[model samples]
Target: MHSKELLKGTLQMIILKLLADEGKMYGYEITQKVKELSDGQMVLTEGALYPTLHKLEAEGLLITEKVSMGKRIRKYYRLTETGQSSVLKKVDEFTDFISMMSRVLQIKPAL
Candidate 1:
């Protein structure tokens, strides 16, 4: 598993990118998807995930819908229009940052 410190900084970007691609997902589903995508290398705890999700919703970058699932009500999150645009910008910024760091560290740039 990746260190919490490393995962901490990238969590928001990771969430945004996933929402952009997946359309909408609930908290647990997001956690599972991250784990699957990273081949179990990355796992997000509810402690870390919910706060970030709430923060994004408070910032008006995300909107939620509640759906009935068997005996429970599940809250699903989707990006707002502002969020859609922001994802592209954030992804580009993160890409550039990685490229710059790779160059500085004399490592091959990430694809």
Candidate 2:
């Protein structure tokens, strides 16, 4: 698994990108998706995930819907119009950062 220190900086971007791609997802689903995508290299505990979800919702970047499943309620989150635009910018910025880091570290792409 990646260090928490490393994952912390990128968590929001990861969440936003996942929501952007998957439409809407609940907390658990998000966690599982991240694990799946990373091939078990990254795991998001509830401690880290919920606060970020709440922050995104508070920022007007995400909106939620609640649905009843039997006796329980599940909240699903999706991006707002603002979030849709923001994710595009975030993805571009991160991509540029990765390229910059590779160049600085003298890492070459695999052929």
Give the residue spans of candidate 1 off by over 4 A: 109-111
Top candidate, metric lDDT: 2
Task: Estimate the TM-score for candidate 1.
Answer: 0.95
Global lDDT of each model?
0.95, 0.96
lDDT of 2 at 30: 100
TM-score of each: 0.95, 0.97
Which regions in candidate 2 have their CA more than 4 angstroms from the true location? none
- Candidate 2: Cα lDDT at 63: 99
lDDT of 2 at 90: 93
lDDT of 1 by residue, 1-98 (tens): 77899898989999999999999999999999999999999999999999999999999999999999999999999999999999999999999998
